[model samples]
Target: MEQRKEITMSRLQRFLVVSLIAVFVATLAPAALAESYKFGASKPGGSWYPIGTVLQRLADKNYGDKVTVEIGGGTGNLLNVMSGKLSFGLASATSIQEALKGAKMFKGKVAQAKKVRVAAVLYPNYLFWLVWAKSDVTSYQQLKGKKVNVMPKRFSFQALNQQMLGALGIEYKDFSKVNYLGFNDAVAQMKDNHIDAYLGPGEENYAPIVQLATHAPIRILSFSKEDVAKMKAANPGVVPFTLDKTNYKQKNDVNTVQTFLLIITNEDVPAERVYKLTKTIYDNLGDFAGAVKAFERVKVANATGDMGAPRHAGMDQYLKEKGLLK
Candidate 1:
């Protein structure tokens, strides 16, 4: 009877311990699951898609259970971040600068961009226009009467468009038909011969255009020194660049303007979470250098560049701790 009693007590104690652990895990599930975030990569046609993918994988690999990235892009990411619908997303430094001023790109949505903050600098991009070989279009002047997809709708992209076109002494009305569409749609339509030309501004060897070239056999329109000068006159941030044919599938080099890209968040995110994320990025910056063509230049040292938006307090704290902040 004594042996049986001892055995029964041991079994009871084991059952009680397991029950307590089950309850503890159940209680923590909400907070654990709540850590996941929706990030915007824009459409599949751009660097945001692929670069964002690599960034997501790197973050998840380091802090997978604490983070999740979603597909999104353009002003959608900015507006969503403003609305607290996203944890963060990618956007251009120029547009974010304009948005912070409550004019230019963001216009009436100053409140939205006001909530926005920079988490990291992804890379820089350059603007280049392309036409199909069959179009017989040789210059920006020839695009005056043709249907054109300007790539940037109105918000984040409009500034670049205005700057580039203004330099050329042209406007949206100069085109017979103008559409504000994503890079993916523009590439698809161009491939089908639905559009005459595409005005694309992006990182060197942007995937959508690079992919489009493989099957479409396209050509980038060359800019004259006077046109480039006028473009530079429009935006000082806009610098002259040359895209090598060997890199982007063109027969020759193409001249364009350059700008920086960034990953952005809003003030709504908790400081701890943002700090943790910023930590993950800088700790693994070297691993991301060659994730994609444009990201090759990524450096933890550039984490504090003039991204035109305020840095999230969490991000700033991490940078300060690392002495990465000046």
Candidate 2:
């Protein structure tokens, strides 16, 4: 009878050990699942889209499902984070600054701009005022009394168009007609001759613009040396940038205004996550350059050069560790 009791006691102990092991496994599973992070990017077919894809691939490869990325409109990137729709996004320094300062674009009296900070300065996005080569408009000043397609509502391009026009002492109402359209729609309108000009920021060799230039001769309105200075003074964030002839089908240099395309994140995101994302980007810098030619212009030495706002603490820490920041 004692032998029988011993066997029963041993079986009960084994069952208890198995139950505890199962409970521990169950407790740890959710933590593993919770590590995945979501990142927001701008529209597809642009520079930001590919960069986000590269980042997502790198994250999946390195972290094994620890992070994911989503793409949306660039204009809404900052507000999306503020509203908690996204964890992070790509944004223009100028727009982000205005949002932070609660300027014209933002609705509230003061925006929690301090909450949004930079991860890295990607590349210079040049403002291309594309006009038909045969169009009578030769200069920005000449665009007056001509129909212009700035950009659709709620987009960064619209804000840029307003600021630039304001500096030039021209307003949308001053133009004969102003059509607000998305990038694709604007391109279509230009092709249809419904608009005389399209003013917005883009890479020097942007595919759609290049295609347009091929079918119909297009002239990139050059900002005169004096106008360039005026723009810089009006908007300190405006950087002097030259689009080399090689960047376009037409072999002629085009000088214009430019701004930094930045990787932005909110302070609420964990510093560790930001650090990891930034590190991944820097380490795979070559791959990114291959993915997007514009990335070739991005250098660690100049990463924060044109930034209008403060860098994120996590980015600062990472850059400091690499001695990129002093």
Candidate 3:
């Protein structure tokens, strides 16, 4: 009886030891093998945020344990990626062009901005000028001497505001009061009637504009044909875009200047990784569009348009495969 009892006790002890070893291996193994990819986007509730989320989900689902993504600010993201602080990010064509040409925001910093290429032309962003419907401001030219909320310094929106205003022969001092507020702050100020005008680029279905329209009558001011031509002539990155009537609550079509938002990465990133990321985004376009209505127009074939820089080799490869590129 004693010998039988000893045999059972020894077998139970060995089983517990084996179970502990297996658990430890299972817990630590993935950490050692997993790879991560970072993508920078704008703040939450912004268009870039949802796009980043879609990319993250696709990477997670397709790459499994191999890759991940981190989303952050727009222009700030470009700086980070260029400095090797991030793997990839989203940027506007205008800003990217400035960076490449060492113009405006990129003056004396161009050396830090080379070899960046497009991953995709994500979507079109309209330069919006939201104003109270009661206001007499029907066009960009009429906003002269009126209070305006231009974006703050270091923000890409701010740079764009300055460039567009310059193209129209307007200056900061020309406005009665120019406040340097951010997107949320600008929306709040507009709601409170603290400012007469706020100019910036955003997705077509921006929530703040819709919410404001519900309470107060608002108008999306349009650019004149001459002004649009001047803007396009001055800044090749600026493109003429028209917002359909339904996009705004006013039920009328509005013409405006726009900049294309694009996914960008340093050319130094490995081709395989870029290929994987591009492939994942294309494979899951439906999922992205369903998640965010703003992404409804995104297509793999349209990934190369309105780009200010060359296409990344990896993305180029995928586009060639899809017959999107020659």
Q: Rank the candidates by lDDT, best first.
A: 3, 2, 1
Q: Candidate 3 clashing pairs?
A: 41-72
Q: Write the per-residue lDDT of candidate 1 for residues 1-326, one digit (tens) a residue.
A: 99999999999999999999999998876557445777766666566666566667766665553444565555667767777988877777766655666655466888787888888776677777778866789888898989988765533455577657877889888888887778778878888878888886755667777767787678788887888888767655566788787765667788777777777888988887788667766676666556566667777777777666788999989989988875
lDDT values, one for every candidate:
0.73, 0.77, 0.77
State the local distance difference test value for candidate 2. 0.77
User: 1-326, model 3: which lDDT tens digit per residue?
Assistant: 99999999999999999999999998887565445878887666556677777777677666653333454556787787777777778777888877877886567777777777787776677788878988998888889989998766655677788888898899998999999876678788888888998787656777656666776888898777998998888678888888887765665788888887777888888876777777877777787787766667776667867477888899989989988889
Please provide, for model 2 over 181-271, each residue's C-alpha lDDT reduced to its tens digit, 9 standing for 90 to 100.
7667778888988989988877866766876877788888887788888877767777788878666554478888888777788777787
lDDT (Cα, 0-100) at 108 in candidate 3: 77
Off by over 4 Å in 3: 1-34, 65-72
Worst lDDT 10-window in candidate 3: 64-73
Task: Tell me each candidate's RMSD, in Å, in order.
Answer: 5.2, 4.5, 6.2
Provide the global lDDT of candidate 3 against the true structure: 0.77
Which ranking of candidates, highest TM-score first? 2, 3, 1
Candidate 1 residue runs with Cα over 4 Å from true position: 1-34, 52-61, 64-71, 133-135, 152-155, 224-226, 249-252, 285-291
The model with the greater TM-score, 1 or 2, is 2
Worst 10 residues of 1 by lDDT: 62-71
